[model samples]
Target chain A: MKLNRTNLEQRLDHLYDVIVVGGGAGGLSAGIYLQRFRLSSLIIDKGKARSSWMQSLHNYLGLPPDTSGRKLLQQGKKHYDSLAGDFLDGYVEEVTDAENIFEIQVKVGRQNSRNVKFYSKYLIVASGIIDHLLPLEDMQNVYDYAGYNLHVCMVCDGYEMTDKLCGFFAGSEASIEEMVFNLSWFTPKITIFTHGLFEVSGQMRSQLQEYGYRLVETPIQKFLGENHQMTGVELVNGSVIELETGLISMGARYHNTYLQELSLEMKGGNLVTDKLGRTSHPRIFAIGDLKVGLNQVVVAAGDGALAATQIWREIRKDIGPRKWLMNLKLPT
Target chain B: MKLNRTNLEQRLDHLYDVIVVGGGAGGLSAGIYLQRFRLSSLIIDKGKARSSWMQSLHNYLGLPPDTSGRKLLQQGKKHYDSLAGDFLDGYVEEVTDAENIFEIQVKVGRQNSRNVKFYSKYLIVASGIIDHLLPLEDMQNVYDYAGYNLHVCMVCDGYEMTDKLCGFFAGSEASIEEMVFNLSWFTPKITIFTHGLFEVSGQMRSQLQEYGYRLVETPIQKFLGENHQMTGVELVNGSVIELETGLISMGARYHNTYLQELSLEMKGGNLVTDKLGRTSHPRIFAIGDLKVGLNQVVVAAGDGALAATQIWREIRKDIGPRKWLMNLKLPT
Candidate 1:
């Protein structure tokens, strides 16, 4: 790649109408809308959207039922490409706020690198979260049916496990205590398996007893399943418990690394914003799993659209209604 | 009609998690995502979703690149129904915000009948805009090829008009002043066809000259086309300006009337929600077209998912994370 001069000072993209960081489904979706609104914007993604690794996506509408998460990310990126929306497959280092602009510093490469500074009028943080997956012996095997058989959000997949024997594996007591309760949404036949670690409270034990759920604290030998579906689990104590589904309630690591400096109100590890996708700072916005809400690919994509549109409206307001309206229609 | 007292609350056909106020693409998409999140929501429609009446959709991704807008809407509703989301063929009279609940009064039947209130905790105003259609001798013939040939959003359909002779039809000189300039995205070959309206000012005339666009202001109009493709417009001056495509920029009135009572930040004809789909009103939320920005079915669906998940996070926080986690299995 050639070290090129910046793309002109007055060329709009230099002083972007909108800047969307972390190009997951949410970021790309925002990019598509901004393009449609005829706004000069850019999406800077390090090619590390959390949704990229999801094995299966069961509930994204408009897509074929039971599609893969990786495929959805690809399609979202393709959609953004179609609009000719400017995007960089680079990581955003930091963002410094100003009157109505953001000074963004980006490191362009891993080996032979470059420094790029972008000035943006508005910012949308569509960066999704990082799932906390266990380092099991066969991780690739476990992820093959990750979204289908093994999942995170029970609300997104619990109803499908009706009347089926399910397993709740936990790394901590709080997770164990929580799993014992969340599984009651669909089925009653649940078995909580802890890897030789038990920190259950006396009150929790009585509650678990009242619910008639069996507890297995033995270390797991391996996951027993046919093909990719989890059928059961074998324990080190030489016990084989049959199961039809499994939920691993470990935890989540939201990719809010850049947001550490920018103080924003967060509830349950998510940035809080008003309904228009605006963050506490007017120019700064957040979407997808990074915010305090649902963690679905479709949801992130929608947040992308909302934040982008909000940015569009604000940007137009600056250009004045007459200029904004005159430039609203695409010439042909 | 019998009112079942014992199971009275459960014996309702219009009970919903969030009663969306429109039945267009946005409402349909929102309904689908809400159901996917397993929220019992209903879409109250006035049958005027601009996209629903269109014959095709070109900008929406994932379809065959040339899907009909009506077919897309049908598929959207079908997707929602598949997931068990409800719909009502009613017109909403008013929406009252009560603490954390919304009492939406809707007109279901003919005169001399009792109106019903759809009580929902959350409200997604996917209720889209009502496009002002020109009432000519044959109004039906004009809207036949709306999504296919005669479009609304320039971003959604501009690229399709590449290298094609397109016309921008406006009702007033003010509209002509605003729309003609914004249509610069599709192609440079454009002409402003004013259907006998106000005279253009010198400033407006200069802008048109600077952009090298031709302008026409005349009366009478027969929208002529063959095989559902607009061929041209026959002017009242007995002149026919041959063209391949056109978009009627009369105007869009986003009916967020249901949201008027909620004391939220309203901007540019939309309810401003934060990055996580939270409105200024703590208990209220808004998404889709009513929330502003790029109005599309996929975008609305995404909004629906975000709103639900945001609520889920708040619900999880209020009810505690253990509420979702409380029902799962206990360690054995």
Candidate 2:
């Protein structure tokens, strides 16, 4: 059933086999597999996944190299829906475990929305992370080319910035120190832009000098770009710095806050999962950016499959197969 | 370069960064990631992958539930080729390690094929397993519906046979004992066909009797089917046991003979790998069916990405990034 405010009340009456948070690659993948396994599942998506903002996915296999992450997510949702998996656009607020059932409290939509509660035997948290972008009065100026020439995720876009005048936008000295080492792989001509966000350590400044790299400490007014291709940044001091490409070094906001009350084992900001994506909590499975593994779309999709299959194995073993159920006469 | 026999000799002269020994979902995924990482790679495929024979892939994310594995592999190959990754249709015969380079000997084509040797800094063994089918004189008659109705993987196709007349074709007594317990999940009406391959133990016979299941120890003449949907099996005794769907539990042939000389590490028939798909040997990575993990297309594709990213990180650290290379004057 496609879940909305009107039908959400009716659907909540019956407990789902699994409640998957976040309808991104991982959640959608899990939904499709669970439905194929004949398990009832519902996917509650907060909003756009971090991958959806990606301009192009150059590494995912079987896809056109230029395929955007948004297109993949759209297709994944369609695939999950085709299998009769339930889906809803809602932000999960809290989850509490009681008597082997997970009570999930969700708020549908962003503002002045109705709250709903759902119950599931198993819980899969695939709520992906949200990248932290530059804080500005008009953040849209930065986002205009955020996923284009102005990028995040050095691992995904470092190759695209080869040999160009690269700008590193850092929120802290530590971010600048680490990003410079990573960006050097693609280009030697790099300039670190502190954007007057934080003070750079003396040791970090010396290291940058030793590497023949430049550091700019001026606060930026707005990003200068055209046609969704970032060219440079204009500082508030009335001086403009030209750049061929840019990388944001600020970290991400992991959307696992709702899970904090459950007190599940966590490593850093991610939930540590076993090889099969099962968290320390037996009935809770974590995948994608929420788990301690490589944050790639393909990896997340694969994680979803493993978790779904493992859950099915556990359920199958417990119920001793569906043989007895076949013999039961139904009220049809 | 696309490696045909003509250019195979010339291409072998240059050592590839990584030589992937399979062109299935796993190998092609790794090839795409490697090329995107700006690393030279070559994929050597023996021919048709096990996935290529799959009638439908119901669990893979973002794809239609009815998408065939052959279609996925075809798209994966095209994606890899677009990134300029080299591909060859050949069977790897041997892999020898000497002086930090893997010398791979391959036999091209099946009939009086030309033997060729290639060198690589790293090796990814994605050569997946091949399933063993019933050895009937007219096995193609069985294969006509093998992937469609005569399924091999119970985990993948058990739901498809729900409440239907299922036939469990087991090669050995042990296989029958376990497969019967698993097949019972989908349907209670299951008949075990030994095909005169093994004698059923007394304990096993009693267990089948207790479950109200039928056991046929007859030598099968052929499987009767039409339009790629299995109908029944005809025995040499001239009796036909009707079945709506069938599950084959004859096991599989792991394709890692070329790495026998290495003797790196093994868990049963599979090579044990770390979270990043690294085997005991530092330069030798294993993914897909060769690795000890779930043998699914999505899992294999994820394994490929993990293996490729780890390989790239190692190479990047060793070479001190691509910055210096950017400054080098070209021959032109």
Candidate 3:
């Protein structure tokens, strides 16, 4: 069934209608929808989606509890490739928009010698969020149990955390409150350790007292563990608190450098999109974790579909006889 | 290895904080979040989702093409049930809100005589949409090819229409123009017809002319088919438009009647929900296909998670000391 295929270099002159930057759940889903809508698309991925760091995901529907993050990404890439979607393993360095056409500058490869410019009519930024790692010297040994015992999302791993003595490793900001309140859902034996000064309102302090949460303002000198599993934490006060599992509720720092370049509005760290996935920048759209809201795989996929459908609707209007846009008439 | 544990039902009594009224992707995802948020929740569903009408879904990312809608649903349910999530198989006859509580009346079983009532502090409407079926005097033949060759959701099945002549069965006033325009995405060889006067717009008429789409105003006297797959349409005008595949773009009627008893705000036949899945009434939340925005599984799941998180935030505020939400006079 193998037919002789022509080289892609011969077809280099064909410009894509849209180029999706990032190939995580959001980007891949958007690509699937665009291709179905009959629009040519390409995905540029540095291959570091948050799901890649996941050891195992229990809440990802339709997947087995033993499903590994590595396996999930591999399967997703295969599915995208099956559609004949194009991809270049590289990093998008900068983007500039002028006259509704986006000029993307990408730096690819190890030596970083290769530089290429791509022009697209529309852009969808699915660049996912980046996790702030704990500054423990032995952080690698601590992260090995991420998919199994230690976890980030309570919705994804709370069932496993139920009835277990859990420790929330938070810094001196909103992470302290987020951990103290959310960890209450899984177990009552919860302790919030602030590596610095604990900030709280008067009412919040009273609530903490009522909830009976043991709060320690002391910092952690060392993370004691055995075979990649955390056992206890040595405090700066020359004391230790034994624990089975702990979540580093520091903060999710998104690589939103590209977003700063655009004159787009932001709400809750995600691109402010309407019912359709349209940003303030009319020609550009954003979906998935990059755009914000619940950072789930399924939600990201839906964002992709919604964005693709909106783009398709626009294409239809442009391709049709109605060349009048914003009172400007086109030669039809 | 399974143990018949102690009965937790006696303690549960009418204590469910939230009751999600469907077990589709939206309901299950909501259940997962609600449970993780420490809300005593139950999901009652008949287990029939919109995707149930799909044979193969090509746009739902991260899965192989050979995956069936049934497999997706089965796996989704398995994921929910594994988390000790409760779902009753029944049809929700009525949903009435009283003060801050919700009462759901249901009819269960094949006998169709048993009635039951369930109560919850809050409600999340993940009850997805239902597709409306047309009266084809040939009922037996029409039902057989439902999820196979006959399709809905062009975003899900449009890729299969490539290089194939598609016959769109509009049959209704609402679907006439939409069907003609949407089907234009896949093939140029598209024929659209209405059973009666399909008020054609000036712009639409020109698109039809430019695209060379055959439009027939005559009603179909009979459906031409064998082995449950349609081959052609026999028009009352004694005309026959042969087609290999058919798209029933007729229309989908949303189930919003249950919300009518309560005077909730509605916009364009959808419940008006805020960013946190809150309806006009704070006690009530809407998720999945029943609410506003794109009717997608992923979006529904996102709605469910948001609703659960909103409810969780409220519960945490409730559990703390000194009635933080009761307008207590704060000391200056």
Q: Pick the candidate with the highest TM-score.
A: 2
Query: Per-prediction TM-score, please?
Result: 0.74, 0.95, 0.86
For candidate 2, lDDT tens digit of each residue in B62-92? Answer: 6677889999998998888887899999999
Give Cα distance to truth, residue A187, candidate 2, Å. Answer: 2.7
Error of 3 at B321 (Å): 8.6
The positional error of residue B236 in candidate 1, measured at the CA in angstroms, is 1.6
**Descending-DockQ candidate ranking:** 2, 3, 1
Give the lDDT of residue A111 in candidate 1: 71
Q: What DockQ results for candidate 2?
A: 0.49
Cα error, candidate 2, residue A275 (Å): 0.5
State, as a TM-score between 0 and 1, how close model 3 is to the true structure: 0.86
Expressed as tens digits, the lDDT of each residue in A1-332 for candidate 3 is 00112233342455678888888878888887787677888788877887777777665655665677667677767777777777767678888887878888776665734667777889988888876655656666556655456666665666677766777767654675665666666666666777764665667556665666666677777777776677777887889998787776767777567556776898767788776678888878888777757777667777888888889888877885222122233448
TM-score of chain B of each: 0.84, 0.96, 0.83
Better of 2 and 3 by TM-score: 2
Tens digits of per-residue lDDT, candidate 1, A1-332, equal: 11123442233346888878877777877777787677777888887677666565555656655566677667666777776777776677888887767888777778776777888888888776776655467777567656657766676676577667888777678986665565664566778776776676788667776676777877787777777788887787778989888787778887677777778788878888876567788788888888876677776766676677667656655664223233335666
Q: For residue B52, what is the lDDT in candidate 1?
A: 66
Best by the DockQ measure = 2
